[model samples]
Target: MQHQPPARDLPASWPPERTAWLNTGAPMPLLGLGTFRLRDREAVRLSLHAALENGYRLVDTAAVYGNEAAIGSALRELLPRCGLSREDIFLTSKLSPRDHGEAPTEAACLRSLQELGCDYLDLYLIHWPGTQGHPQGDKGNKERRQLSWRALERLHESGKLRAIGVSNYTIQHLRELLASCRVPPAVLQVEFHPQLAQSELLDFCRQKGIHLQAYSSLGTGQLVGRPEVVNVAERQGRTPAQVLLRWALRQGVSVIPKSASPARVAENSQLWNWDLTHADMEELSTLDCGKRYCWDPSSVA
Candidate 1:
């Protein structure tokens, strides 16, 4: 069996400053801008401006998001303005569920690169474990994902995807991949928040040297105003959004919170240089009653 990097439980720089070393030996920013529904070109431009100015080095997108072209155009127009270059940022996109098996997955990754106007992606992910239009429990889902991972592995080896990962995978899905993948995943992106803590999955990722990155850390904005979250924010003198996002950071998971507003984009990047007290961390942990505001991958076979 081929050996890989051993898991390190916390970021090398726990109170991460500019960047932290990922399992692939690449430095990743602590916070990133998630461009899920942010497709408008102008909105993408303004948000990219705010995010780069506020020290965000990572921009996460997916092919199905229908915004890669706009984001690519925005970056072309904005990076030079920010006094940065292509190498200065970590760009990430995902393989769509529509392209599941090996050939389609490989072609889709290439298409995303062209759409994003990049010769290579800093990171790429299998957007989901199941094939599009397939029932979650479909037996073929497992084999399809296995083939998709093979495609990603080839891309990683080709330097097209500097790192490869999976998004929206459950523990079972990860275990299935880990058993056979030549390149172990560098990250696992999921709908993680106070309500959906995903404690078990987080632990497994830590044990396996895979980074757990959180999306929908605010429960799709629903938990921002909750009495518990608000109380912590009030006590900490920060926005509820900040408090909720900080909760994940304290637990050592990376976060990508999507926002179209410029101010909100900058606000989410203010996670550095602060600490959420133990009391607040504990308080937020109690909110984890197994709630999920995003799609649940557990139903997938």
Candidate 2:
């Protein structure tokens, strides 16, 4: 998942602990099919079909990935075929960085909604803290993000967005938003895996009641082959990918693991009906050395 950046015919029924509650009291699946590089219309349909059939109810996409229309088209054809309605799926799309002002943000959100063929989104996020085309620490970036948040606040109030949040925000950035916004964020999604645990940010989100969602949960496939991770997988008779994803789940964090292979997508959906022990948790936690596989948001002002 760089730009930046699972099992078998397991269980169909999700345990009570498998879901995370957003601040708005909305439930989010800890596991979902993330569509980052799946841009082709056929590819989106294939993955979405596999995911829905495999008991995955959450699908995450973003504007910058250029796949909203593909996902929208796929959902329209596939949902009915899969025996589900739009409400049965928790669809999430994000605000584009180029659309970082009040009016532009609102327009972009509406366009995404239209593109995705949804009346309302289950969740929407400010894709980044800094406005594109600006320097890393530019003051205008802060202003634009503030204005963008105001736009999102209005949309949330209007019920266009069921829940609103931010992604790739550091603690400092979240502090700014939490202090000034009319609505506190419902979730804080970031690059999380064993290598980059983000302990302080997790604790802060927990303290403030913001659900922490993990992207790049496999460290872009770099961490899956590690000795420690493989050891746990061998011991538990699971895939290393599942170990990494389960690591996030056991700690009350949610994950969106994107894979092009429908088989891999199905494997990732088999996260339910399993447990990672306390010792497994401690061993996986040792991989934390603050190495982020994705681009860091700490550079943004």
lDDT of 2 by residue, 78-156 (tens): 9899878776778899998899999999999999999998999989999999888988889888889999999999999
Each candidate: RMSD: 3.7, 5.5
Specify the poorest-scoring 10-residue window by lDDT in model 2: 1-10
Error of 2 at 61 (Å): 0.6
Global local distance difference test of model 2: 0.87
**TM-scores of all models?**
0.94, 0.94
**Across residues 179-234, which tens digit of lDDT does each residue of candidate 1 receive?**
99999998899999999888889999888888888999888889988999999999
Each model's total of backbone clashes? 0, 4
Candidate 1, which segments miss by more than 4 Å at Cα?
1-16
